[model samples]
Target: MSRYVALGSSMAAGPGIRPSAPGAPFGSGRSARNYAHLVAERLNLDLVDVTFSGATTAHVLHERQRSARPQIEALDGSEELVTITIGGNDVGYVPLLMAASLPAIARRLLAGRVRELFDRAARERALDDVADALRGVGTAVRGRAPQARVVFVDYLTLLPAEGAPAAPLSVEHADLGRFVCARLEDVTAAAAQATGCELVRAGHASRGHDGWSADPWAVAAGLPLPWRPAPFHPNAAGMRAVADLILEQVGKN
Candidate 1:
């Protein structure tokens, strides 16, 4: 049996997948059907999934959620595989991106004045902080699990690519959404490269399968899933897609 460690935020945790983790510190939401679970089961690996909803890179490094220790506690020298999907929460990108797509706010996206509403400089600085934190996480995980094959799985796509039918979002909202998500991928990519971690290009792998497509791995902004909290986030299919991505990169049959 191979030892595998999984860590990261809700993207890796799959909050809405069903039958949440048994001891998740009261409100640290989790799911047993997350991509980690799917991948571990498919590969027949010993899984130590400590993924949590809303977890930041800091949480994985040292911070704790209530009674739960850091996510690093789940890993040990014997691990053969490790996967992490974090950093988005460090900049609070998900909620901000979802809010940006709201009708009340998105309706004003076409206006140039939208840029004047928020502190763009502050937001950029926050993203910079995320970049720094991600590098630290990559480095620390490597130090702790030196023998483990570390795969830094990036976040999945939320909106369509540049040119596509914007069924779920207004044209302007779709553009803004893609831009935000693209930058997020760029940040993660840079961190992955800097840390010598294997980068699983989820943004590229999930291209046409965005929320706007006929068959979406992720849900559209306004379309809420029966189980998930937000209208945005990955569905069951999305989790499976990520699992497949790992398999592809790992040369697994």
Candidate 2:
């Protein structure tokens, strides 16, 4: 079997999904059913999954997360495949989504501060950090595994399209969430192009399947259910969708 190393944050780890990945640290929050595991099963790959919840690119490239090695450190020149799904945490995408889900009174009370955090200038600055870190990841991976097929899978869409009724989000906050999501998608795509890596347009493939859609691939913000995905994260269905999307490219090659 060819070796495959998966890297990234909660979006890739499938936090709170049932049946924790065998031997994964509790803090990692990795699901046995996450896209990486699923892809490995279908392709019979020797998988080294290093994804953890709340990982920033810093964690993937250098910082030890929850005492585990930096995610990139899991790689060696022998691997044939790698997949990355990161950068949302760097720009506070999930935090903003959580803020949007606060109760009406709480949201109103915190609106000013939240708006400041999402200010266009601040967001752009954070995005610059994300872009640079992604470039670093691409460079390090290429150096470590010159023969691997690197794939940059961007985040799934988390919000309803513009003008859709997104409950829990007042119109203003909903609009703000959409804008941030879009910018993150753009940055991820640009990084993949600049790195000469294969790209999986998960965000584009999930357009009408946002958390607010009838058949949501992503989990909408709400009370956490036992063994279910955390709010603003991918659900099992989303994981399956992503796995299949990945196979579409890998199987062809």
Candidate 3:
């Protein structure tokens, strides 16, 4: 009666933090210190962590990678809790943002045209697809784990109020990235409402302390994890924040 299943992409998987666990389809993304593990430890629940580095909603619905089982299959109507942070990779979130921004920062001295790598029309279509996929995921989870409390966890803020300084990206580039992330959060909220899952708005909870700040919960695009090669994901502080947030919702301190 204490089974807790965790699933999602690199953020939920705790990419940079160690000791990374190995799986068949995706070798190592799950961290021993991820929010899921922390929450499980705090609540004394059996943890079934199946998060991967590049997992899309498709991965959760029907294994996207070889040897990777459908993430939802972990449930059997016998779990107590479930938490997930997904959809970022679906539209190439971090990578696209970086690609669109880095060139500007690298050559800001020249005042060149900051080429827009992302096709606006294509991006909009892809976001729509994400919303559809999210609806499917929510329905599947509710059906599979009828007794479990499902929480759709959102990603942490990646930039400070003034934008990330480490990228040394221009104010324009940083502001654009932040705006895109904010829209993504909005999309997640709509999906959560449509599917009846309690939304854990981590983005709102994790403000100011973005990759740029001294007390950041999230890391910059290339900030390496302690003793690991993880980047563009939540750091230890971010993971703890997620765990605490979930615990708070579950009525536990």
Candidate 4:
């Protein structure tokens, strides 16, 4: 039997929305739908779900190095596939962007000087930290499962557009979102190249301003629970979209 190990954050763990299965957690009032389970079901592989809510790449390394609680040894000696979606929480980048944007909104509420200052600093730090974390994740995954086909997925773009109005604020939030996503892509791609791991560009499937204009994947922000997470997290449909993209890449590899 081909065994698969999936490691990452709540997105990989299927927090808000995922395909239903026995023993799955139920909290966000949505079915436990994670892309890992979806990929496993699609490919009919034995899945080792080593994912947790609020996980970062650094967290994964610590757990592996120390065999800490929620250790990834649960997926040790993997046989075939290894999918990872990490680095979003590292440096608390996402929250930082949200925080920085809030005060700017309290003032003039535009992507002006204040937004620029916060975004530039946050993006630089996040990129560097995430790159380091990806290196660690790549090394750890390769060490554990030498034969497995490892994949590192990039974060999805969450911003609206240049001139669109964003909820709870202005379109400036979208700009920061784009900046963060772009940096994530760079670090993930570079790390994958350095570590000889396959890169999965999950961001392309996201509904950006243009994509949302045609076909939106996630609910509008500040709508309601089960529609969207706090702000950056995906809804059920968004998770499913991610699962689909992951399965596609996994199948090709």
Measured by TM-score, the strongest candidate is 2
**Maximum-lDDT candidate:** 2
- Per-residue lDDT for 98-199 in model 2, tens only? 877888687688888778665767877888888888888887887888999999999999888999888887787788778888888888888888887888
Which residue pairs collide in model 1, if any? none
Candidate 1 regions with alpha-carbon error over 4 angstroms: 22-25, 103-119, 163-173, 223-230
lDDT of 1 by residue, 58-137 (tens): 78989987677899888878888899899878765676555555566563754443443233555577778888888898
Clashing pairs in 3: none
Off by over 4 Å in 4: 18-31, 64-71, 97-119, 207-214, 223-230
Worst 10 residues of 4 by lDDT: 23-32
The true-versus-predicted C-alpha distance at residue 66 of model 4, in Å, is: 14
| Residue 202 shift from truth in candidate 4, angstroms | 0.9
The predictions' CA RMSDs to the true structure, in order, are 3.7, 1.7, 3.8, 4.6
- List the candidates' TM-scores in order: 0.86, 0.95, 0.87, 0.79
What's the lDDT for all of these models? 0.78, 0.89, 0.78, 0.65
What residue runs in model 3 are displaced by over 4 Å at the alpha carbon? 22-26, 100-117, 162-166, 223-226
**Whole-model alpha-carbon lDDT for candidate 1:** 0.78
Q: Rank the candidates by lDDT, best first.
A: 2, 3, 1, 4
Predicted structure 3, TM vs. truth: 0.87
lDDT of 3 at 6: 93
